[model samples]
Target chain A: MTVTLASLSQQTGLAVLDHLERSASIPVVHGLQAQGDLIVIPLPVIASSVKVWPDSHWKDVPGEGVELLRGAAGGNPHTLVADPGTCRWTTHVLDSDQLAIGVFETSAVAYLLHPEHGATGCPPGTYVIRRQREHEGQRARLVAD
Target chain B: MRREAAEIREEWLGRALSTLPADRPAAEAAISGLYHLIGLAPPRFHWVSSPVTALTTVPPGIRTRPSETADRVSAWPLPSQFSSLMRQLCLALDAQVRWGHQSMDRLIRQKVRSPLALSTEGSLRMPLLAAHDSRHRFQSTWYDTQCVSWIAHYDALRRAAGVLFTPEQNRQLDLWAAVARSGGWWWPREGACVISERPVTMRTEVCGDDGEVRLHSADSPAVRYADGWDVHAWHGTRVPSWVITDPSVQRIGREANVEVRRCAIEHIGWASYIDQAGLRLVASAPDPGNPGSELRLYDMRRETRVLLAVNGSVERDGQRRRYGLTVPGFLDDPIAAAGWTYGLSAEQYSLLLRRT
Candidate 1:
């Protein structure tokens, strides 16, 4: 499922509350927009392997990872980095027009876990957890190649 | 706290008295609203020139007059009665209104902490959906928040009259008040003080961003609206369900040969005594041949105190009706009944018979 600012802004507070009350976690297909093109990538890939901060971007090991260039690859990019631990799930309406989705912390990724390259490799591509069969005390499965 | 209570009492009384012309209509409106808040019908009130004199000697029905003739109204300003009224009103109000925010509960606590703040002037807005009734001379309208002021005012009058009751008798009065307020149908069921209502089950399910469906079993009943759900659970039982009429006078009446059910589970094993003319145990008995339980009668105010051995029959004496008390066999103390009875398990006897 694709989530855009328009689609998210249209959702009601009750819907948001229902999700927060019953769901342990949500799966988001995250990426970044630069210039104009979009670079689809897994959150764990960047949070663990790159020196990605709130304002600063990879200026070029850009490491030994896959180079994902979207739109014009040279312009400064705006991104939202959410710490899975700190994000609050609520349906509180902050204002009449603006609904609070949640808060995200911008932090640097020091290591990325890879099946073959241990915790030092940064793999490219969008990844998400299979939430269909998830139950209490059960963790989501990483569905990324 | 004493000073605060004093302030509350003073302020509440002042606000209550100030709200009216204090006519029969005004008094009736307040009383009607209080009854409606608790989902009860208005009791038949016989108008008297002086309610103070009339109420001094009374039967089952309680009496009250308007605030205009302030001196005529009895049972005001007494701590025990006033506090009891406050507590009762709070309970009834809680059951009727559904709040939108948790902050509302906190606000009520703060406002009602001192009785003075518990007036219609308080910030709480409790709007009860009133339907039209053409039967009455005039349509009755009452809000729970507004009723607090009246309760304070009337109870202060009761205090001034120097009305007093023993703790046990007070408990009975409270019970009678609840019954009267709830239109005489509210009773104890499954450890819950509930009006006549059916049971319900609530299930919560969410569709995740990944299109996955998650199911949850919720104990509270919830309302689904525009993507949000508000849950409401039965908040256990309210106190004062016990009515102690005509103090304990041992009377060993007819023997109703009723079978007593064994107390199996803790929640199921209970009994109660409702004093109709005199004290009689109301309990459910185990059916030896049938699968479920039966109605067994027990008289608490007797030396024998055994199950009234009546063969499944309601015994009546002339103008007096002697209904069998459906009490649980597990209860060692007769006074501990919950105004209802439950079926007991076979192993429950060991638990009950076990001498500690």
Candidate 2:
């Protein structure tokens, strides 16, 4: 299935969805996995994201809430992504719903994987696009019966 | 486009392999070993709040005044281990640049002028070219590879930290970042090494009072400055006051007169010349309003103007007359006559020998 950031932003509410169509001299999207019609690339996948996450401990994030998205932006609230460089593997497993909308055509994906293009590595074939509740926050404490 | 560490390592080793005549396996293994060691500790980032003190409006030449208020500034410290890794990596990088120079000389001798060199030997001393060049080829390539790898990593780190600076901060930060990029080659001499475990911002520590030892009024002796006699001095907060005074005189009817008391002291903002009796003679004070904090003293002559060094050193200039003193008849040696100066220790008398 094919996807673009415009469609992803409708579902995810992230502005980074808008940049998916822009072309870069270096391929930002190394590879992609499908979740029905959705295309998901890993969060903080770029070398530049190393700055946003900085340390190994920040690799794991909690939920796909607005608060989480804002924090990931590193004070840039308008977007959900920092400037992307070449791709690298991340231990972080972000939900497909949380990922910004984007798709790389087969040729584009091939360009990224090409040795000359200097893509770090390709993402795995399948993605675990688990769906969670829209508002995954703590419930009010129940009164004792 | 940023290349992965592996891709960079591969390209480098491939080039090295091509350059080397033999030992391909060993060269490859050595390159891999270096890669593993460097990869073991990748640079990491941290968000931290550090104490910062800001100072404004510093007087020129004087150290800036340190502020009293405490400020919390956000800063990122490179991982502690990275500092050691950086030093090691820098030494290796410097070695690479050195090998490049070495190879150029060898290439000229072995390839360009080999025939000429053979003719000069005259069958007496035959020079055999060693196979060491092949090994150096691998090492040279490996070092170059590591340099590229390190540069990429450092560039990434800088990019990651790029947002920390605003436009104004960036202009200054870029200057420092440039220094930091070349910083891998900077190594201190063998005796002293001060390594910082964490990244730190530059700071100036200004004190309200210049740290100079004040002399008690009683320690100063009275002195008279003669006209055409020059008093040179260096003065500042940090300077220690030492006055080296030499008095010269022409023969009088009975006693030697104080003709010229030439003295040079450390120029602080203010300095003066006094007679040996600890009396105020001539004062040269720099204008406090002048930002230069000028450390210069002018010639002074007069008994009333007192020469005071807040914390300064005074020294005798070379022109102090050597022949004016009369030698005792008992001291027969001409060397002693030339060396002897009244009121000086043997050590001081020896120092006067250079004048002769």
Candidate 3:
């Protein structure tokens, strides 16, 4: 079955903007992809910087979806959406720079839905999700766009 | 039970951030009831337009205490006495909860009480306190007691969690709820009580999973009062008005705070600021996942260079937003700098498939 913004919005009961192409099937990518301030990369790509803990706790991504990050001002979240039992997320991954929010493993295609940025599909694999940051004078501040 | 607690939390949160005019009569009656519990006569009512005004001026009939004055609203003992009264009521209510209900009680504290407390602190108390003094010298029990988060927690216990309360305890809770819903912060004294009116306008952004909010506005004051007292914020970080109104390259250069400088630079788009500041471009390359978009790197400060990138998706107005990310000055390659942001190597980022 083809997955579009309309179908994801309907599946999660979330509203998407009219400006987005509602009917076009979303593409599934197997490589590094970014959405707004978050970047999703395959686990092996950043193995030096990210490590999964031995006692990592993982939770299944429910049918409703799991919210990853909520954008500032607009307050819309980047939700990781997939069929139940197909994916799980763990926040116990260690990042050298402390940027990783979690690691997600999906047996099937996983969709990340957002209101303004539309939706992007992630093919089955283990991926690390990290937030963007900018250098301040002497500090590093997380980017919240 | 969590859902029910959330509903109760929303109801109280609405009242906490309310900009509505005060209900004078209801406030006075509930306040009188509270005074009656403390063995004092109903104090005369003193109303002020803002918390700052309440701090700067004393009520007409009362002499002042140094601790209770302007920025030192912390040292007052009366509010602590009221806090004790509340503490006793909570201890009584604690007895009514059973073993099974204890977990529900903890969940209520997490889902409703703690988040509400955080929201109250961020949205109301912090801004008002900063307005008077930035050091935050005064104790917060005075304001913390007045915050409806705790009251709402108890309310959830009784109404939603089905915990029983003594008739007298319920009566006191009702009085506290009435005073809270009636108006803003209040100060109880020996023979008088002072109350402040809510802000005339407040703008906030949702900042947390549990419905927390913080003040934020781009061009206007995030919070304003009937008087002219107002606060300007940039995405929840309090900032000077110039950062919003007149963000110039010179002003940004002179600004000592790096966060403020970033906010100001961002107020003007990164691309525009780079152009206006006349920073030399180090390198530019096509963004792999974004198809037509380009990633340009520019010299920003002594040890930092900014990478200007275009949004992967078009906005509602048919324009793509340009954003800047500050990276270490060492990296000369735009793709390498972008990879450093996510802890990836230059080669790892080149395989980017899509961005949207």
Candidate 4:
């Protein structure tokens, strides 16, 4: 049974749902958060959740996948998690050190050994981060020349 | 200075009368010629300018006959009235002359002041005294030159009056006498008089002699008279004429052409109103103090002199209307060309000339 991280998160706490949904794939959830009016979801969950999530949520979600979602959600201290395949969980990753703990979870299917590996599997709704990287590169090149 | 001018004017009047023509025809010709020169139609003549032609050594062909003469003449019953008019004219002329002299004197005094440096305050200082001097100079020049023409006119009138009438036919003198007694030919009394045949916008007020003031529209029938020395004022784009009892009260009602002395307690005098006719008439008197104080005729056409008791009442169908006022149409006569030309600045004269 394939279930979106958003559906699992709605049924359970964000931490427990994330652990289940990211068992084998990145899970993305798009909707309002419990803390404020802002929208929050895991970056990797977009690709896994897009087909299952409601059409309204999919429309308002950013187009460049999970990297963009992380960029918007990154600065604040709050953590989030995602799974790219199978049963997805929308969960929080509390810190950079805690990202390793996901390998021990019962539903874990793959473990990203490096942050770069997570970047390579980035899901949808993360275009803003890519654009920001491209803009910085252009500015750096012009200054150098 | 005005009194001096008046004395000189009286002497000139006597000289002018002595120069009159003895022959009726010559007298009539000369008088008619003078009238034409001054822009008036020939007046009716009796024994002096017509039948009395044989009494003087004037040629019969030289006389200009009147278009028509009344079969009878009215008696000269208003002697004091006539004399008063003459006195007013003399007084006006005297005032004009005195004003010119005084203005010149003022200019000279101003010129004697030391010139000041152009500091910030100095730069801001007004040049009023200099302007006044220039104005006075202009007046003095005009008066000195044009006064002769005025004297000539007076002379001509005196001689014509002497030669144009016989003792028996001199009743016409009563008309002139009445005009004089009423304060010259164009003098309007100091009060309100019905002046126009048309309705107009008007404002009226009761101004106390002690300085109390009130105002209203002319359409209102009830108006409180100003107390003794108090003045009832009225003015507007169009004003209905009414009677004024006291000359002083009328003077107080005037609101224009007033000048204050430097002392802040003396007004120079009131401005005169010269109607389209050659009549120089008094319009108002200035307050003793207050330089800016003046009486203005909102409707010049509607302001008229109030005939006094001395001039008698208006008569209608052999019935006497007591305490009446008269407005002389002679000023409005088609041939009359009266106006103020002397004692004005170039700009002022231009304005007057344009209006005329």
- lDDT top scorer: 3
**Least well predicted 10-residue stretch by lDDT in candidate 3 chain B:** B66-75
In model 2 chain B, the worst 10-residue window by lDDT is: B122-131
> What is the Cα root-mean-square deviation between model 4 and the actual structure?
44.3
lDDT by residue (tens digit), candidate 4, B1-356:
33333343334322221222233444444434333433456544433221112112223333312421111101111222323434455454334334335553332222211111111011111111121222232222211111222332233233322223343223333323222222100101111111101011112332221111122333341122121111122221111223122223244345332211100101111222222222334342221111223221212224332211110111224332222122222222111111111111222212211100
- The residue-level lDDT of candidate 4 at B315 comes to 26
lDDT of model 1, residue B97: 36
Candidate 4: regions farther than 4 A off: A1-145, B1-10, B16-26, B34-46, B49-99, B102-356
Residue B203 alpha-carbon offset, candidate 2, angstroms: 16
Model 2 C-alpha lDDT per residue in residues B36-93, reported as the tens digit of each score: 4445421111111110101111123332113311110011111222344545544543
The sequence of per-residue lDDT tens digits that candidate 3 reaches over residues B26-132 is 99999999888887789899999988777767899798775666544545666777888888888888898988789889999999999898888778875677657
Quick one: best DockQ, which candidate?
3
Model 4 in CAPRI terms: which quality?
A: incorrect
Give the alpha carbon lDDT tens digit for every residue of A1-145 in model 4. 4443343333233322122223343322222111110112233322232222232122211111121222111121112333433222222222221111111111222111112111012233431111101011112100000
lDDT of 3 at A44: 86
DockQ of each: 0.01, 0.00, 0.67, 0.00
Kindly report which residue stretches of model 3 are placed more than 4 angstroms away from their true locations once superposed. B1-6, B66-72, B100-107, B135-138
Cα TM-score of candidate 4: 0.13
Better of 2 and 3 by lDDT: 3
Worst 10 residues of 2 chain A by lDDT: A136-145
Q: What is the interface RMSD of each candidate, in Å?
A: 32.6, 39.8, 1.7, 49.0
